[model samples]
Target: MAEKFSGKKFSGKTVYSGITMGKVLILRKDPQIRRVKIADPEAEKERVYGAVDRAKQQLAALYEKAVKEVGESSAAIFEVHQMMLEDDDYLDAICHMIQTEMINAEYAVSVTGDNFAGMFAGMEDEYMQARAADVRDISVRLVRNLSGQEEVDFSAMEPSVIVADDLSPSETVQMDKKRILAFVTVHGSTNSHTAILARMMNIPALIGVPMDLSEIRTGMTAIVDGAAGEVIFEPTEFQCSEAERKIKGEQEKLRLLQELKGKRNETRDGRTIQIYANIGSVSDVGYVLENDAGGIGLFRSEFLYLGRDDFPSEEEQFQAYKQVVQTMGQKKVIIRTLDIGADKQADYFDLGKEENPALGYRAIRICLKQPEIFRTQIRALLRAAAYGNLSVMYPMVISVEEVKQIYAFVEEVEQELKQAQIPYRIPEQGIMIETPAAVMISDELAELVDFFSIGTNDLTQYTLAIDRQNQKLEDFYDPHHKAILRMIRMVVENAHKCGKWAGICGELGADLELTREFLDLGVDELSVAPPMVLKVREKVRGI
Candidate 1:
């Protein structure tokens, strides 16, 4: 007879969203390495180099596969892994140990890996610390290849939620992602590559679970509530049935929403609302269409600037913008120019250390200081405008004088484009009302732009004098403060008075409770995440 096990629940952080029920598949830990004396150091060194070559070839193949499985952006990590494998520091450490210590190739690579990983692990920055995993991953692959150890065959397993102490980016990519229903890591950060892969795979994932693995058994049924960051195990039949019911209900809701795709974005009162999606990259256009967004309210152009050694050229930017504009056809696409700096950093920008980056030079401030860079982006946007409906939006706009200066620069770019005989159009221009200064002078600022999009997230942070990044002050950070609502009302009213439409593209836009309030205040649109598009549309229909 099957032994009856007690039911247990574990709480953790959600890295992605979905509810899934499956059997447990515990990922085995890395095998232990035994140090052995080498009779031939020269031979060990040759073997180590050979392993590197093999690892490189394997990673290259994996990179191509990842590109097809996920997108190029997510797959780029494999390219980075290839570079890490060939890094002089890493190679030199392994070769030095093999030549000097007469150690086996596997032992030398293992020591070198630990040394390099420790260096990164000791870094003060969390992002840099997370990079240590990459070092360890490459080293392990090299060691495995040299030792002739077989890789884990996830394809042989039935569909299940993968439970692990941790998973490196490489491991996550190399695994048979198709068989994995979800992932639950006992040790991992929300910013880790595991989390990124989970998101790219569009599967539910939970991380930072405080669970004792000894208590977990393979083939044990488990329920993962990814949104709530909870995992239930060995639930009663009643509980399992209830969870299945909820899952079906959610699926039904989504099915109904899918039916509403391409439907008119009209409220119950017959008022039209421009429902749009905010995307961070060109690849997100697929989801935008899937959700039937009226248009793209914000296309964060910073992705091109980040994770690179140099600034993106005008041609590079143009091709990207053109692809998106052409794909969207006549649908409006508003590209928000380079909101880098602050939390989002680029080494090439040389945006020196700032005691208060959030309040200091960032976004438009950096762009304005570097006119050549700004002109490059403007030229790209203008050239792309020829293809389809594309509008440009400036972030962190604070004054009428700043608006005037921006116009002056735009005129220069227009003249340059004309002289070059470039075919383009003067698409609609707008500014993000995210600062208190902008909100206070919104009436004057309204007359300077074609429209207004209230960035309620930053406005609330700046107005409340609360640091949104600080978890300790989360309770005090109120997006619903009367001050924020009044500012939104002010921006919307001023926009109307100036013969312009007003929309919100912040987190507050997805707040269903605030939908009627915003509509009542004359807001014309709500731009939200792709997942919230249908929900917001449903709310709009209700109103």
Candidate 2:
């Protein structure tokens, strides 16, 4: 059933209210890309196992030209593409092909039992869509390398919005931020790197525009109102006026937020609440400092592992960690090391496909099994401590035994650091009180760590046994459910009784209505998305 909506415009603006037959923004993309078959299915064709290496050399040349012509950061964007070409598992199959030397791209790719590479490229999911660019970027670079083509000068390219099927992290980051007005991808999510980078750059962007967005001409005007999740294609007279008014309103709200920015988050009666930023990368470190956040309440170190094709080196990890610490200066930055789980981890380490991944291999369970991987991450974090106040946090700590084991490992690394005379910093360590077992051990767990940060998103999922992402149980996953609030109160009050602080770095932290309840429950700190910082601060201050 096609239901159309009609409503009067809000008092201050004009609107095109009648239902017109056109594409609408509802998370689905416009003119979905037709799946492409990369390799031939049946033939005596051969594979080039060393094709990725050829791709790497090509990317290096392109990057060299990019670095000299553009800024260093623009060139640095190619690292992931370079890393993709180096994926051992991905390249291993290519190397082990059994056939003649020459083959078509399809023949080369057809050796695999499953078309994971093609499927990965075809996915609508942001992270997975990013892989598409990775595969293609490497492929294109290899083609150029093999052809001995001269690199194009990036300096002369004019800034223009890219209208394409989709973009990978590498592809999105490579474009000139100054030149690109906005990205009109036929497919993507609000959380996609394309959307995220747009927000970061303050560029007006609309994702998932319906009906062949690529066909939208080069100079056609578009109003990418991401907040409203809509795009106005060559807006009408009424739309022009309407958009101007909405922009004014949004800008006024932002102005009001700026007025409240940097102001202490305290109640009129003198109750103080610590406001912090929830972050995953060094790029976010600057947001915390600029916004006067009390500290980085939840610094997810997963970026070191998440979204990467390979594990980052200890020194490489340290450089990223040290950047955050140095940028933070004296304030504390709590770093949560590698929170990969079977259910949430979209990585190469196949843990035997299971029916229910949520209840299976995840968090501490996966980390404990991969001791070498865990130790390397811990060692990198410890080394990063030499720069400033850096605290190590463990995620998905489910039981007393798990906490004891990981804490013991931490001690082992500390002792090893001392013996090696490695200069490093080790701030107070803590646990993410997400799992029910960990929450049950609040008193005993608090004794083991410096503080507690409640991951309400996971806690809600585990406690209610409702996967928020499932959409089916979204109704049952309400944060306001009595059971969830009770559990939150139980965890918060328990932490306080144990003389420890409990902070919220979950989606609940930013919900305006729930903010009061969270405050009432005595949450010591609130870490939120960057956009909500000033609003939450203002709301908390008035309370």
Best by TM-score: 1
Best by lDDT: 1
- Residue-level lDDT tens digits of model 1 in 30-58: 64677888888888888988998988888
Which ranges of candidate 2 are over 4 A from the true structure? 1-58, 61-164, 177-211, 342-352, 474-476
TM-score of candidate 1 relative to the true fold? 0.83
So what's the TM-score on candidate 2? 0.73
Q: Looking at model 2, report the run of 10 residues with the lowest lDDT sum.
A: 12-21
Clashing pairs in 1: none
Clash count (model 2, backbone only): 7
